[model samples]
Target: MQAAISFAISLVAMSFGIAKLPLGPWERGFLALGLIFVVTSSFTLAKCVRDRQEVTEVSSRVDKARLDKLLAEHDPFETKNL
Candidate 1:
């Protein structure tokens, strides 16, 4: 929540700053487009990183479960027929 609020504040501040720039409309439009691109790219990167971490966590859990199942079925004192 805090991070979201901060992002919103920053975005608004940047927009206002860009609007106040002395540059012409075309340049301001370009800068706004660039800012939007950067924001979207950052979101995409963040989502990718989060998805990767989640996948890793899920795989680790599956591996742990497999190890536990194997251990549960293991016996130390079982007799073996040769």
Candidate 2:
């Protein structure tokens, strides 16, 4: 998809930029490490958000089903036996 393509392009561009930097190899290695950490953290955050949303949706569905079942069993005009 477009998002995948964009991500790839950006990663390549960043790598090239880092390679072209005048800094020492150690600095570049540090920057690459930071970039990797950021990317991994971003993925983790996105997965966590998705999982939470899915849980919320499932909880809502269960609540709605319970309400529907209660309503189905309810009878407004039924008189209770003494």
Candidate 3:
């Protein structure tokens, strides 16, 4: 969600900056906002990819038999005391 917002902000800012090139306001604010959004989205995407990779790596190392055994021990319908 944040990545999407950042991308949108970046696009808007970049557009503003481009539009201002002809009007002569320089659009410094929009340009800076665009840069910030791009950086933030890049970092967010990198972190998400890293997390997904870690999860995939861990899942690949799991022992199916042990997992089944653990699941078999649980009673899904039973209520437990906290």
TM-score, each model?
A: 0.95, 0.88, 0.47
How many residue pairs clash in each candidate at the backbone level? 0, 0, 0
Off by over 4 Å in 1: none
Model 2, position 36, has a per-residue lDDT of: 86
- Over 1-82, each residue of candidate 3 has an lDDT whose tens digit, in order, gives 9978986886787776666675444565566666778778988999999999999888866766678889999889999889
Instruction: Provide the lDDT at 4 for model 3.
Output: 88
* Model 2, span 18-79: residue lDDT tens: 88999999999998998888888988999999999999999999999999999999999999
lDDT of each candidate versus the true structure: 0.98, 0.93, 0.77
Candidate 3: residue 27 lDDT (0-100): 62
After superposition, candidate 3 runs with Cα above 4 Å error: 1-26, 63-82
Q: Give the lDDT of residue 21 in candidate 1.
A: 99
Error (Å) of candidate 2 at residue 19 is 1.3
* Consecutive 10-residue window with the lowest summed lDDT within model 1: 71-80
The residue-level lDDT of candidate 1 at 75 comes to 98
Strongest candidate by lDDT: 1
